[model samples]
Structure formats: structure tokens, C-alpha cells
Target chain A: MKATVHVTLKPGVLDPQGQTIQRASEAIGFARIADVRQGKFFEVELSDDGDLEAARAELERFARDVLANPVIEDYRVEFLSDLPAASEQE
Target chain B: MKATVHVTLKPGVLDPQGQTIQRASEAIGFARIADVRQGKFFEVELSDDGDLEAARAELERFARDVLANPVIEDYRVEFLSDLPAASEQE
Candidate 1:
């Protein structure tokens, strides 16, 4: 099984990187860019025996435990289908 | 409505940041870490009239056009419900 984890700042929290992106967007003429928050993405491959729910729980734990500061950040989990190329090797 | 965009390097493509994170992970005692790929996450607010599919398409275009280099990266899009506090304003 494979999964992706996305981590971002919770709303109402200040994000300096997001503000920089917004300013850059305006400078580039994309005036419609209302807001921007920056975060991290992780792709993880797990044992085949793991199901999506299990993967999600594990990934969430990883996020809160190591990947993010839970007090200020939020995360999303996604389970991905192993591509044929990836499956062929295992 | 709100959405998040996750941009990641496709498999087989090199990710230096991921390697750095992996080293950090191992330094912290996570020996089980198999692979790591780093990417970016974005939080965006869209007009309520927008549907998920529409939001996804727009986000994909944005990713390909600016957020990522399509040659070596792939992106996933997620649609999120506007928080009650955000909705209460309008």
C-alpha cells in the first residue's frame, strides 16, 4: 500500500511563507490570489497487508508524532493505488 | 469552499529535500523509513458556486502551469468544506 501525507497550517494561524507567496502572486499580476499557505507532502509505501484505513491511521500518527507540530498544523491523508511499475518489482 | 493542492516528485525522480528528511528521520531513530519524497501543499479558498470537479481541474491547471514542473512532478487535489467560522462571515 502507498499513501501521501499533506501538512499545512490551521486556519486563523499566521503563515509568513503564505504571505510571501501572496505578495509574489500579486507581483506577478495574479491579483485573484486571495490566500496561500505552504506545507509539506510525503509519499509512503507500506506493507501490502495494510488497508487504506490502517495506512491512514499510521500516517496520521506519523504526522502528529514527527512530521508536524499538531498545535499549529493540520494534515490530510491519501491512499494511492500502487502503479503497475511499482508493483512489478515486488 | 476550500481546496488543497499537493505537488510531489514522480517516482524515480530525484528529491534532495526528501533525502534530507530521510537522513533526519534516521538520525532521530526511524530505521523503518524506506523512501521519502518532499512536495508542497497549498490551501485555497474558492467561490461556493464551484464544484469539486471544477475546483480540481482548476487546481490541476495551476499546478501544471505554475505550482509544479509537470516534467518530473505530479499533483493531487483535495476539496475541503469551508469552516463554520469562515462561512459565518458571509
Candidate 2:
């Protein structure tokens, strides 16, 4: 099993990186872009057991313990058989 | 009309941030994590016109000119109507 963890700042939290990127987007003529929020994606391959729930739980624990600061950040875990696809979900 | 641009190091490019994260994963007992690649996911809200193709093309240009170093970074663009979902696609 493979897992992907996306770590991002929780809503209402101040995000300086996001603000900077938004400014850069405007500078580059993406004036229609009103906001930008940047996140980190980690792709990890784990020993496969065909159990998504267990994998999700373990990955969530990993996020809490090491990957993100719970006070300001939130994370989502996804199971992938191989590499993740190149699109963001709707 | 929102667009997402994921920026990652091109294959074979050395990623110091990824290396550091991999080291940290091992230190945290994710010994099964043989490697790690860290990528940036930018979620941008764009003015919607119900046209995905043009939005994607514009985003690709943004990636080339401002969002990433095209020589070392590879990027993919996705269109969304609202904020992106939590799980990564597989």
C-alpha cells in the first residue's frame, strides 16, 4: 500500500507563504487569481495489506506525531497503489 | 475556474528537501519509507467562465514563468470550481 499525506494550514490561520504566492501571481498578470494556499504533498509507499482503514489510521497518527503541527495544520491521508494521479480532485 | 498547479522536482533532479524529510521519516521509525519526494500544491481561485481548457493553458504558462523553475521542476494543472478536495487522486 502507498499513502499520500497532504499537510496544509487550517482555515482562518495566517499563511504568509500563501499571501506571498498570491502577490506573485498578481505580479505575473494572473490578476484574476484572488487567493492562493500552498500545501505539502508526501508520497509514501508502505507494505501492502489491502486494508485501507488501517493504513489511513496509521498515516493519520504519523501526521499528528511527526508530519504536521496540529495546532495550526491539518492533514489528509489517501491510499494509493502506486504513484498518485496528476489531478486535483473536485 | 480555480486552478491547481503542483510543482515537483523533475525526475533525476536532486531534491534536498525531500532528502531531509526522508531522513526524518527514518528517524521517526517509518523505516519502510525508502524514499520521499516533497512537492508544492498551489490552490488558486480564478474567475470562472466554465472553460477548463483555457484555464489549464493559462496555468501552465504561470508555472513556466513564475510558479516554478521549468528546468528542474515539473508541474501539472487541474481545474476546479471550488476548493480542492482532501484526498489525492490515484
Model 2 clashing residue pairs (backbone)? A1-A48
Interface RMSD of each: 3.1, 1.9
C-alpha lDDT of residue A57 in model 1: 57
DockQ versus reference, model 2: 0.51
The sequence of per-residue lDDT tens digits that candidate 1 reaches over residues B1-90 is 567777888878988887887677668765455566778878765544434454455555655676778899887766676445534544
Tell how far residue A9 is off in model 1, in angstroms. 0.8
lDDT per residue (tens digit) for residues B1-90 in model 2: 567778888889987877887788778776455566777878777765655555556677776777788898888877665323323221
In candidate 1, what are the lDDT values of residues A1-90, reduced to their tens digit?
Answer: 667777878878899987887677667754445677788878765555434444455556766777778899887776687445434545
TM values, all candidates: 0.65, 0.77
Candidate 2's C-alpha runs over 4 A off are A47-56, A82-90, B49-53, B82-90
Name the top lDDT candidate.
Answer: 2
lDDT of 2 by residue, A1-90 (tens): 657778888989988888898787888687666778888877666654655445556666776777778899888877665322323221
TM-score of 1: 0.65
- Model 2's CAPRI class is medium
Best by DockQ: 2
